[model samples]
Target: MWKSRKSLVELSGNLRLIVSHARYGKANFHGSNTHPHNRIYIVEKTKSPDKSYIANLSASPGQKVILRPGHVYFMPKDQTVEWNFTPGVTFVAFHFGLEIFRGIDLFDGDSEFIERPVSEDFTREARELMESSDDLGHAVRLHGMIYSLSGMFTDKTMKAVEQARELMREYAPIIHYIEEKCDAQTTVAELVDHFGMTRNSLSKGFAQTVGVPLKTFMTRCLLRKVTQQLLTTGLDSKQIAEELGFSSEYYFCRFFKKHTGMTPKAYRSDILH
Candidate 1:
């Protein structure tokens, strides 16, 4: 830990950082509606996995980790990971835009799972101080917490699904095309024609490998793109909706509110604030 209790304001310029303190057990592992935020989680009270929800994009097939107190985990932005947690687990999670650290490279920007060991004493103290600190001070504390795990970054002690890509090798070109045309006025029927496959074949094939139905995956991608615009662009809802290929602005608002708890304008306000 850095000994100086310096102001965190300097380290956190233009950083949109938020922290969540939570306890969970006996929780079903709901898949994440993955977003563009990179995340950091630190364990406070590690308990049973039977009730402890543990899921991530990096966990290998049938691979799982035994949660231990004093461990910290990192999730890269835009990865399809599970955010659910099991019961009796106390943890603090931090989420921020990846671009905030784009120049620093403190954490792995590409890996899905990064774990590091910290002393339980330090973890508990950091959590308490982080919760009590004022906005700027709180950010500094979080930055310090990240620094404690810096050794893991230097050591490369991360476990990612290195082989998962090989399994979906067949859909490599198709997936790339879909992503590039994600906002294009494209439909599944058109996709089927382009690939010379039936709807079920493409959808099922993608689900088999991507863990999400094809249409659902595409919808999530579109919504994520819309979210970025909502946060960063000045385009009105109607214009943004049409650009993303929605049937109408009304439908776009409903879909946006469904995926995100707030309407587009509200979401933008909250983020900007």
Candidate 2:
């Protein structure tokens, strides 16, 4: 079922999941009169289209564009677009709310639109699965399709982010050493020796790329580890503190509360409840 703007409730709640697999055989104007709520469209065509457009932008076949089938097209609630469906064009489309795709900075415009062709095999299997199901089975098939489509974008985005993160990964040995010897009160000298860089150069490069002082980042990482332990394990504050290389449980509690605005115990309680 195609949803018009008037009946949208998914955007208000910040996220929604839409799943469908079908063929569009007629020419129709999508989003001609009203904007859909925040949504991502994943469409796979059984037959090739002559042309299509999102808003005023045009898409051609096999361009590695962002919104192609097996990929995602994220758009805000107030944006407008048009689709010119060629006859015999069979496609599966999925819609997701904007919140579901928050923090992904792939598209270059206000509307998160990416259009490119996807692998024919994947598209065929997805379409087949959707076609052979109904109700809950259809829902399951659609969920799987969404999962696959989301992963495609996520993998691409993560690769881009990972390029920026590689410098930090290179410093992983030092970071791990610090975490291990936190009680021994490691110094910058030790990190410098292990990484074979002058203190000044190391600090400058880390700050430029990671946007945090090395010491500050180390402390944050340690604190995060402690927080996870507190939440997931039965360990007390003291045990967590000691494991994270904190000088004392009181100091750890104070540090955690300072950064997180809640005591570790309180945070754990809130999460659990």
Candidate 3:
């Protein structure tokens, strides 16, 4: 449904949201881990009759949030959170990413985790999404559920999102080109030539506007594609490296580990499990 407000339409016109992993069952995770994508959990039961919680080690050494039944909790990407759950806890969990510009995450710099009570309307829609049998219908419902849940956590980032939407408009074509070239092992010099801009201008402009050097953004674009394949496909490291234009499996593993702090195999196993 299209909204009447022009600002709303323009701001969200290029938004991209991907829900990569979702699961529902008894809470079975323990220990600390970092994920490269955003995550949300809807609590159904507590660890005990009391004391249902997870600690955000990134925010502080031992900051904990109490999980209440019917509450939705969000943990930002690339941050470590410690899970202290018992068999009695259960949840519906989704791991997803949201971007306002190509490769630019909406919650890019957020380190704090947040929680809010699930609304009646959202819970009803989630039920419908779970019951849906048609594949396309299920995907649509699932995306809607994630988008709605995302709204609950965006209060801190809303202003930044709006600012980014405005700042990145002039560089949209460059962003899109880099995203398209992500699988090709593209380079900053290639972007300079293709865009017909001098090295200095291209580098300075991109860094100023996007908050990262152009080369850094290119690396992020490649990392995003690599992680997406790792999450969604059965391709092994060698195949992924060959398909994405990496020189070799060893180099690909090094690059992935250098940027993400884990090898592709470990990332896939940790997230999938």
**Tens digits of per-residue lDDT for model 3 on 50-83?**
5667888778555788878778899998677787
Give the poorly placed runs of model 2, Cα more than 4 Å off.
1-159, 165-184
Candidate 3 least-lDDT 10 residues = 123-132
The candidate maximizing TM-score is 3
Superposed Cα deviation of residue 162, candidate 1 (Å): 2.3
- lDDT per residue (tens digit) for residues 10-32 in model 2: 33243334321123222333333
Q: Specify the poorest-scoring 10-residue window by lDDT in model 2.
A: 99-108
Task: Give me the displacement of residue 212 in model 1, in angstroms.
Answer: 1.1
TM-score of each: 0.49, 0.41, 0.81
Write one digit per residue (lDDT tens) for candidate 1, span 217-273: 567567657876776678999999888888898988898776655678876654444
Error of 1 at 232 (Å): 1.8
